[model samples]
Target chain A: MSAKIMGFDAYNFNFFWLMLLTAIEVGVVAQSENMAWATLIFVLVSIGVVKFIGIAAVFMHLRFSPDSNVLTATALFPVIFIVLLVLMVGLTSPSAVENLPAFCRPGYYGL
Target chain B: MSDDHGYHHGPHEWSHGAPHNSWAPIIISIGSGVFLFFFAKAFTMNEGMNGYIYDSAPLPLAIAGLAIIFAGLISWWKQDFSFDGSYEPQATHGSTPFSNVDIRKVGMWVFLMSEMMIFSSLFATYIRYRTSIDSCYSLEGTVVEPGTACWLPASYFIAKGGEHAHSTLGFMPDALVPGAINTFALIISSYTIVMALKTAKRTDLEHAERSIKVRNYLGATFCLATLFLVMKMIEWFIGFHIGPFEAPSLLSDQFTIHNDAYTYNYGHGAEAGAMTVDIRMAASIFYLTTGTHGVHVFAGIVGLGYMVVKAHKGGYGPGNSVSIEYFGLYWHFVDLAWVAVFPAFYLY
Candidate 1:
C-alpha cells in the first residue's frame, strides 16, 4: 500500500502532465483575444488555482502524508481571511469596487 | 559504581547529561528584530523643512543590526558542524499532539504558515490598489472629463508611444515567452529535487553509490534553479532598458508620464525617442510582486547551494534526511507562489 496516488512511477508522470497543462494554459491566455476580459481573468485564476493544488498535493505529498489533515488545514485556513478581506473591500470601499470589471459589478452581471 | 548509580535515575534528570545551551540563535533573533524595525523606520521618516531627513539616521543602525544577525547565523552554523560541539538529536516531546510526526517537520509547516501570511498581505495590497485604480479609470468617462485618460493596460503602456493602442483597453505585450520558459525551468528543478530526496532515502544502494546519485541530482537542481534566475534577470534587463540596448526604459520613460497622453511608434521613426506609457499604479504593482518573487528565488538558490555542498560531503541519508525535506518544502512553496504570480502579473 503505497500512499502515493497511482503509485510511485506516476509522480513524474503527474508532474510532466501538470507542467504541460500549465504551459498550455499560459499560451491560451496569451493568444486568445475573443474572450471577455472578465471571463479571461476568471479562467486564468482558475487555472492558477488548479496548478497550485497540483503542486501541493503531489510535490508536497499532502495526499500521502500521515498528517494530511493538519497540513491541509494549515495551508487553507488563511484563504478564509483572504476571501473576507476581498469581500469587505469590494462592498465597503466606494473607489475600490467602482471600476471593477463588468463581471464583478452587481447589476452588470444580473446579480 | 558512580556510573551505575547515575544510570538508575531517569533520562529527564539533569545528571543524565549537561543540558543543551547556545546563545547564537537568541542573539540572531534579537538582531533580526532590531534590523527590521530600523529598516522600516528609515522609510517612513519625514524630510524636514531645511532638507534634513527626520528619523532617516536609523539606516546605519539597520545595517549594523543586519551584520550582527548574519554573524550570529554563521557562528550558529559553524558550531553545529564543529567536531567539539556538534548537534545531538534531542528526545521527542511526548506530550505533542502529533506524536507520530517528526517535530522538525511540524516546525517547518508552522514556519510556512507565517510565510503564507506575508505573501497574503502583499497580494492584498496589490488587489486593493489595482481595483481602486481600475475603478478610477472607469469613472473617467462619466465624471468631469480629465485632461487625459486615467488607466491604460500594461501592454499599451509598454508599447512605444502607445502607437498600437486600439482602445482604452489595448493589448499589451506581457513578455510571455520569458515567463513561460522560466516556469518550465522551475518545474524541472522541482522534479530534480524530488529525485534527489528519493535517491537519499533509498536503503538498498551502497552508501557511496547513493552519495554520488544524491550529489548529481542536487547539482542538476542547482543549475536549473540558476537558469531560472538568469532568465528572470535577462527579462528584466530587456524590459527596463538598463543596458546599452535601444529599447526604452519602461519604468523611467513610460511609467513617469503625468498629465498628457499621445500615441507614436518607436518602430516607425528611429529618432522618435521612447514612447511614454504612464500608469504608475500598474507599474508599481508589477515591479513589487515580481521583485518579491525574485528575492525568494534567490534565497532558494542559496539554500540549494548549501544542500549541494552537504550532499558532496555525504551529509544526508534515510535516517537523517530531514534537512533535505525541509528545504524541499521551502522550494515547493516558492514555486507555488510563482504559479499564482505569473498569471496575475504577466499573463493577465
Candidate 2:
C-alpha cells in the first residue's frame, strides 16, 4: 500500500528525515567543542530514535499494514527480555563481585 | 491435514499424510553439530596447558560437515524458490490474534523478535563495560597508574580523529569518512530494498519492464551492501590516502583488540608526554557490535544476490511481491541496527 506522511510519499518522507538526522548527528559531533556534550548527546539520541521509528514504521511496514499491530507486537515481544537484561547488567556490570548488591552476592540468604 | 497446507517440503512435493518428511532440517542439524564438534577439536586451547593444540586431522571432517550444510542450504533455498505467493498460507478464521493473517508474515515477525534479543544482549554488554570502565583520557595525570585498563571509545579514532588526526572534509574527520559513507550506503540500500518491494507490487508496468526494474533495484541493494563491508574493511584494516588527505585505519592507529598497551598523550607540553593504557575492552565491544552488524550486511548481500537473480527471471510480480516485503523487513532491520550503532560506537 502506498502511504503518505504530511502530503509526502511515506518512504520518501522517512528517507529525507533519516538523512537529515544523520547529518545533524555527524554535525553535532563535529562541533562538539561549541556545545555541551550532554546537549549533543541528547540531540544524537533523539535523532537516532526518530530515524529508527521512521524506518520501522514506514519502510518496514510496522505501521501501515492491516496486521501491523499484531506484527509490531510480535516484533516487540523481546523488549521485556531486553529490559530485564539491562537491569541485570546494572547489577553485575562492576568489575568486583563484592561491588554487587547483597542479594546478588553468594550466601547472602544464609542457605 | 490437506496436501496444500503450504509448508515447505523437500526436493519435490510430499505426500499429504506423510508428516515430518523434510530431510533438510535433520541434515542441517547433523551438519552443524558435526561442524562445530570437529571445528572445536581442530583447535583446542587450554588455559592450564601448553598453549594452543592444533590438529589437522579434524579439519577434513569439518570441511565435510560444511559441504553437507551447503547441500542442506541448497535444498532449503530450492523449497523457497518454488514458492510464488500464489498459495501464501494464512491463519484460519478464528478468535486468535493472528487469525486470517499471512502465516509467513507472522513467522517473519517472530524471527525478527529473536534477532532483536541477540542485538539487545550485545548492546547490554556494551553498556555494562562503558559504565564500569574509566576512560583512559579521564585517567590522564591521575594517580591511576599507566597501563591501567580503561575504556577508549572508537570515536576517538573515528569522529575525533585521534593522535595523528587529519580532515579533508570540512564537516567531519578524515577517519570518519568510511563510517559516514557506510551510514549513507545502508540508508540508500534500505530505500532501494523498499523500492524493489514497491516495484514488485506494481500493476502498471509491463511484465518485462517490471521484472527488469525489480532486478535492477535488488542489484543496487546488493551493490550497496557489498560497499558497506568494503568500507568497513577500509576503516578496520586498509587506511586510505586520497591525494592531499590521509586517514589511518583503526589498525594503523593501534586501536586494535590486542592493544593492551596503547599510548595516550595527556597534552602538548614536553612534560606531559604520554601514558600507556589498556584499551582492549573498548576495541572488543566496537568490533563485536559492528562486526555483528557487518555479518548481517554480508548475509543480506547473499540474500539480495538470490533475489536479484529471481527477479530477473520474473519470479516476482504483483502476486508474488510478498517475497520482497519479507526480505525488506530484514534489510530495514539491518539499517535500524546501524541507526543505533553509528551513534553509539562511531559518533559518541
Which candidate leads in DockQ?
1
Clashing pairs for model 2 are: none
- Candidate 1 wrong stretches, greater than 4 Å: A1-4, A7-10, A89-92, A105-111, B1-29, B34-59, B79-97, B135-174, B238-249, B256-278
On lDDT, the candidate that comes out on top is 2
All models: lDDT? 0.63, 0.82
Each candidate's number of clashing pairs is 3, 0
CAPRI grade of model 2: acceptable
Against the native complex, each candidate's DockQ, computed on alpha carbons, is 0.47, 0.45
Q: Model 2 segments beyond 4 Å from truth?
A: A95-111, B1-58
TM-score of predicted model 2? 0.87
Q: Give a tens-digit lDDT track for model 2, residues A11-94.
A: 888888888877777788888768876677778889888898989999989898898898888888888999998779733665
lDDT of 1 by residue, B1-348 (tens): 124343321233433232124467688888978898998777542332112244769989999888988787666555433221112233244534554455456667788777777677677776776665543324332433333234454444332223322222133233344566688888888888888877888899988889889988889989988888876665555452333223233443344323233232243354333333235455556677777888778878876886787778776677555566667888888889888777766665
Cα shift from native, residue A82, model 2 (Å)? 0.7
